[model samples]
Target: MGDFLDKRAEHLSTGMKQKTNIARAVVHQPDVVVLDEPTTGLDIMTKQNIIEFIRDLKADNTPVVFSTHHLDEVALLCDSVCLIDRGTSRFCGSIEAFKEVGQSGELNDAFMNIVKQGTMHV
Candidate 1:
């Protein structure tokens, strides 16, 4: 188990620590995984690697719950998304449906439009 543990936590960079956490998280082979800001403070290459790893987990039939503040990441990796603002549900649906509502392909634009309209009550 020595190889599975992060030995460099004290000295490693933030991205390295994040990667180490990810490695540890998957080592147990669980059915579900929840990651919060898994790609935070990482470069583009490292972020891509993390994203791809999540994709692979999904392909293997593992249910992954990913929480991220990056809308672009959500747009790229999520099949369905629920946008919550001020503790209210703004939108809950597929990316395609969300895009249709705003008549735009950009997820951020759609999210902004929904928030602007204040249509997420309840």
Candidate 2:
């Protein structure tokens, strides 16, 4: 967001580019926010900033649907969760119910157990 702001899009770093993209996308405050791996390659600070933005959107009651490999983000941000396995909805419900699925009360473990049960649908 420094000198890069004065430069062309091609000159920005991956994180900076993603940040700008998100900012531009949400400037109008759309009805819903959908992001794909939003913070995957961002720096810690940039990632944190984006996470806060997501939180702010939620606080304002804007529905946020983002795909992330970071389970911690899911734990911190989502009230309900959906797990897609091979283009199928393997699970979709409250976070607590999802936790119970794994029987260990852990996000990562829950995800694994869900995926491990390839034929199960909930």
Candidate 3:
């Protein structure tokens, strides 16, 4: 905290500032956490570290809601997915179910199909 702290909040690099913000979020041990694109703009190593942190949170049975454009991260960390587009939810189900929506059985393809169809399933 001491090394990263800056009076003007500009001394720290983007990654360091992101880490500091993350430390603040977890300091309280809250039951639920909502992280929006936590790995965005981070280096690959830092992104992996954050991903591991998220897995640790899951192991602790803490609920984490992460909104990201990175489908790979979703595959790694999420069991369920709610895909929303244009302020509407297009699909909500397990990751397997999501993959089943496409002929290729790939999450990205399924997502594209859902967007093209503009439909939702419970």
**Clash counts for all predictions:** 0, 0, 0
TM-score of 1: 0.81
Q: Which stretches of candidate 3 lie over 4 Å from their true place?
A: 8-11
lDDT of 1 by residue, 1-122 (tens): 36635565877768777887888888999889988889998999999999999989989889888878898888778888887888888778888888877567888788788888878633
Backbone clash total, candidate 1? 0
User: What residue pairs are clashing in model 1?
Assistant: none
The estimated TM-scores of all candidates read 0.81, 0.89, 0.89
Quality of model 3 by C-alpha lDDT:
0.85
Say which prediction, candidate 1 or candidate 3, comes out ahead on lDDT.
3
Q: Rate the local accuracy (lDDT) of all candidates.
A: 0.82, 0.87, 0.85
Q: Top lDDT: which candidate number?
A: 2
Candidate order by lDDT, decreasing, is 2, 3, 1
- lDDT per residue, candidate 3, 1-122, as tens digits? 67655544567778877776788788998889878789877899999999999999999999999899999999999989999899898888899888776444777888898888887765
Q: Distance (Å) between predicted and true CA of 29, model 3? A: 0.7
